[model samples]
Target chain A: MTTTAVDILGADDVSRAITRISHEIVERNPALDSVVIVGMQTGGTWIAKRLCESVNKIVEGANVPLGAIDISLYRDDYSLRPVVLSAPTDIPVDLTGRTVVLVDDVLFTGRTVRAALEALNDYGRPRAVQLAVMVDRGHRELPIRPDYVGKNIPTHFSDEVAVGPNGVTVSAVAT
Target chain B: MKHLLDTHDLSIDDIVNILDVADRMAEVNRRQVPKVPALKGKTIATVFFEDSTRTRLSFETAARRLSADVLTFLASSSSVNKGESLRDTIETLSAMGVQAFVVRHKSSGVPLQLSQWTDASVINAGDGWHQHPTQGLLDAYTITREFGTPTSLAGRTVAIVGDIKHSRVARSNIDLFTRLGARVVLVAPPSLLPSHVETWPVDVRSTMDDVIDNVDVVYLLRMQLERMQSASIPNLAEYTRLYALTPERAAVLQDHALLMHPGPMNRGVEITVDPADVAGSRILQQVTNGVSIRMAVLFTLLGGDSVSSLTAGGEA
Candidate 1:
């Protein structure tokens, strides 16, 4: 199989997007003390930590709880594909009556977000839940949507959008 | 990968994969809910043809925690007494859409036979003295976690004490520990040792005193009195004097050396000392880890498409 890779968002652009999203998080959720950030495992953990750091920097003496969740157990594709656990879920604080911001690297079919939502319930009942993603490649199979998106780059179903600390790249596999 | 009949069927990759997933399952066990939707709508039937308390409950708890329905079958209460064959029971359950079978039988190869007769995945909880793969995995998981090594026990040494011939746990652990790069020493009387012990990948010790102070782990096996059939030892007192994890021998162990026992420990026969008093004892941790390991097994067999792909190298 042949593939073509193109850089979608440069490193500087990705940084700017994270900074902007962090500001939006603080601005929208006035009660930053009650807000927690949880990253979807493997891909979104780094971004979640970065977002937490940026959020704390924007607010003095703010100690926002950060966690990482592996949603493999809650996914609906067990019969269709292999399911392997990625990382241990580490929710440091009870989410009851607090807001949760779920971070992920890419948002494509919205199925991962759905699984993340179910995974969150095992932690605690949060007052509200929100989604944050670096890339929204738009092929949603569910009624889920991201609250804060860094970039929305539409692509074909076969295109793969990968987000990393370096940047974001969209690989087009020959069909 | 499809059916976990024995530890001999697992590759290094498979063992590591199950241990890694068990870590995740351990975290789930620590959760506020202590449950997941991984195996929702999937049904698991535990068919115990032999007597067991811990293994049966552990599998049932693991299945429930994963949100999978459980069907409990005991030979004593079931139609087996009414002359129903094992094949009839397995086929009946298969027709009822059982996704997996956690089988424990007094006769060896019962799980393997069931696998041949059914389409559902067969997990051999314990089949006579043939194999208890989950016990092996949990024991390996316990040791690996204690040593703070996530993958292998490359240079670690384990001394398994007592009843090697009739111990399914011993058979499974030997396969698993060696596969994970651990040197195993079997400490048992010649009468209690397996007939083909020379073929096994382990060193043989006639007494615990020979290897008590050196090994990283001291594993005690239960004495199968029922299976003894004849006098395997002179007497229980002599057996305890030679093989039990007595306080004198326990005191000689290295400070970091671990004490382990597959449960229903014969208090005065195999381990005379109080497990709680032993500073390095992981007897309870082994029981706790059983749930996590079995959860990993159940989820691996029923909640995934293929074990090979799930355990394949690289980022999951």
Candidate 2:
């Protein structure tokens, strides 16, 4: 039997999920003056940009500043992991007194988020830090959960939840 | 993937990979904490058989920033003075569980020899006048930082002026610059030029004025006064007249051209004070880049984050 990938969220579904997330974020951060958003590098940065646009559209001219971070070096299992390729990590402003919302593409093991939190500590101590993810596939090894999630996909151990600009896909591992 | 003994071992892809990592490591320097745990639990040993100010300090600083344990061994004051051979000294350190060795020696090929004697990865800081791979890399990083990309140097001119025969920096830069597709012009007195320069892959010339106006970067090499008198170049005063980077020659450079020097500079001899301090000069920047490039090298060689462990074959 041939193995194939299946789309979990189509373009319209992805758009609706983002719109819902934007509304939730605006409602939680009403003043919109203290809240700042940052995207984890690679896939998360794209989603963060879209999320920023969606958030701005709701609170006209909020123009929330978005930053991107690559957490390659901050992971707890650094010696065990493979050589991590790095990207730009830019935080335009100090995170000290700001309410920070971290955006990521997928949340499975919760390890990446753990590393992101630790990495953020090097930058500054935030007033409050919240996590927003596009896809949450349940396999968390840590006591961590997303504060705001786009879609939750519960899948098998070997399955992959891939999120991109096109949408989201769930593919079984090729045996 | 084992040891970095020379630039000749590095392909264009390898060089780019290292520089990209260096770019990432540069961010750590700007961070409030200015450190990373990427190389934690690994041990690095620096063996300096020759005297150095920037190199030994830079390597140690890079290792500490990565959170790796650093052990520095100075051969002059260490076991090498008491009847121990180079092999014995390295083997003793290897027994202590060192994962990497950064060696600087007055004799050529010492790093290469150490690689054969130990399983640990060897980084050639400088081995006599043979090669200094990382200096070449930092210079490349400096260029890429200035021009926006290493490949942008394809048609750019880089003229290295001063004593050539005794400079490991010149040899490394020549090998690296030509590999990255830059036209390199070697300007030195006929007495100071290496005898075997005929086979080298750069334009061998005797005067700086002929090539000064056209080059994008002018890198001045430190004159080896120790090698003068015995070699063709007899003294510093005569050598200064033909090749010193003075205010007059620095003025002749194009507006966008950069000035560089591999330091421990013999000021007023090879380069005038003001010329070395010019706004276009990237001398100080190169020193900063040195620490980052070294961190990149250490991380790539020892930062055990395997691609297989995190990517395609990573088991959940």
Candidate 1 on B4-48: residue-level lDDT in tens? 998999989999999999999999999889999999999999999
Runs of candidate 1 with Cα error greater than 4 angstroms are A1-4, A173-175, B227-229, B306-316
Tell me how many clashing residue pairs each candidate has.
0, 6
lDDT by residue (B1-316, candidate 2, tens digit) is 7799999999998998898999888899878898988778899999999999789999999999999999999987897889899999999999999999999999999999999999899999999989999999999989878988745479888999987888899999998888888899999877677897888988977887788788899999988677665867766777787788888888888988999988978888889757545768999999999999999999889876454544421122
> Proportion of native contacts in model 2?
0.53
Candidate 1 overall Cα lDDT vs. reference? 0.91
Q: How large is the i-RMS for each model, in angstroms?
A: 5.5, 3.6
lDDT of 2 by residue, A67-102 (tens): 988888877675566776657899988888888899
TM-score per prediction, in order, is 0.95, 0.95
Single-chain TM-score of chain A, each candidate: 0.98, 0.94
What is model 1's interface RMSD?
A: 5.5
